[model samples]
Target: MGAGRRPSGRCLHTGGIVMKVSYREALKMALREALSNDPRVFLMGEDVGRYGGCYAVSKGLIDEFGEERIRDTPLSESGFVGAGIGAALGGMRPIVEVMTVNFSLLCLDQIVNTAATLRHMSGGQFSVPLVVRMTTGAGRQLAAQHSHSLENYYAHVPGIRVVAPATLEDARGMLATALENPDPVIMFEHNALYNMEGELDETAGAVDIDRAAIRRSGEQVSLITFGGNLQKTLAAAEQLSTEGISAEVVDLRTLRPLDDDTIMASVRKTHRAVIISEEWRSGSLAAEVGMRIAEQAFYDLDAPLARVCSAE
Candidate 1:
């Protein structure tokens, strides 16, 4: 949306003003802005350079920013992640792409032991301004290895910030805010959302990462969710409207610092809450949010808090 660049193809809705872009294109816009606005920012990951990213999100970045800025690392996840952390420590802002959520496990030690703890361990002397972007969520197109929604695993850690952008505006804006945070940030881009198309204003830029967004408002019930499930929940809400069920939708955009205030506000208003998550039921983010709502808004609920999660 800035003078630097715009999404690849253009689509005019009405009045020939607004721009329509896919989730992948919006992400490319975000990356372009981050590279243009700051000198220290750079991207490094597998297939990110010559191959144009596993999902083709970085398709044209290498030509525009060059190989040095749009770098491609080796197959070793831990090694490259550790190098990213070191780059952050040395005053460079690094955005590392891990290809998928499952592959991120290969570098868990570097992420948890080093990147997540370095600031606390160094007594605030070190700050890892690193952003790790990876594909998450379940889909049949990509095999089992690339189909796991493991964002909850990263959200479980104490030091890093976890965010999933489910909308075009968020996909275009969240990266800048994540890059600005002094601590580490992990961005989970659902594989299924890559082709999603939506409209974004010309002036759209960075967005908030500290609060959850209330996507829809109602009174009968609240449909709480994030990531790809937000679209499913909103669609379900539309179907529920035909049945005379007024459902509110809350998007937990930021997973790590769960916005309890927003979640409780919705729960108290609806008096009934159902958290929908793509992760497995046991120890999922839905479980944690359900507990928070039950603990804080117990009296307001007409029935016990509920969760609809992946049975697998």
Candidate 2:
């Protein structure tokens, strides 16, 4: 099997022949596909033009699409972010890269009050087809300022959709779906997963924006998580399996709509649950998952639900 490939009675194969793309390349391809398919689609962010983006995900895009469509903005997250929202209001599908989620705090007013509330406040008269992409998670010791998983903050809002693209497929397909949605969408890409290589099945269909995916299934316990903690949870699951505890891992890709049905189904089957999140333990998304499990699957539980969240 390849590094990321799962066996299906075929012999092992590697050397990147079957799976030849990096996570960053997958995202770039998705953006390229979106721009090619939609005439109104454009990207704007700091250093996105000649600088090739902070992580180089936008590298060469400006060359192909020209400076007009792949416009670069100043270092003002609040200004460009608000402008992106305004552009969306004016009938444009805008993909605004915030560089990092920590910096996105500067634009919280626009993201929360404007982009998130416009449609509801207008009684469905308006829509913001905006996609804001940002790097999230910690591990490189970029310190507190440069590193933090703020997906929960976005998920707490009601109107905006929060998504975390964990796998290559998600990294590839989410941009198009977010662009198509009539509401603002915030995509959190873990910094640690950018270079991780994986397969890209061109024939694979688009993943739903409101569903959870079972990456690995088991019966003894359920390990629920999304985003950066996904790989860690899978590692923990494998370790648990060594001791005879089979862990079912559910990737809650969409946090806001939160495929509760998928979570409930997994909990029902496994009867034991543990949620892992990189955000601080207090009032995090993990707590929300635990509460829902208590409310709906309390009687099905063989033990109290467990959680492993970060402490910052």
Cα lDDT tens digits, model 2, 90-145, are: 99999999988899999999999999999999999999999999999885767888
lDDT of 1 by residue, 119-214 (tens): 899899889999999889887578878888887898999999999999998999999999999999999999889999888776689999999999
Which residue pairs in candidate 2 have backbone atoms (N, alpha carbon, C) closer than 3 angstroms, thus clashing? 1-12
Question: How accurate locally, in lDDT, is each candidate?
Answer: 0.91, 0.88
Please give the distance, in angstroms, between residue 139's alpha carbon in candidate 1 and its true position after superposition. Answer: 1.6
Clashes of 2: 1
**Weakest 10 consecutive residues, lDDT, candidate 1?**
1-10
lDDT score of model 2?
0.88
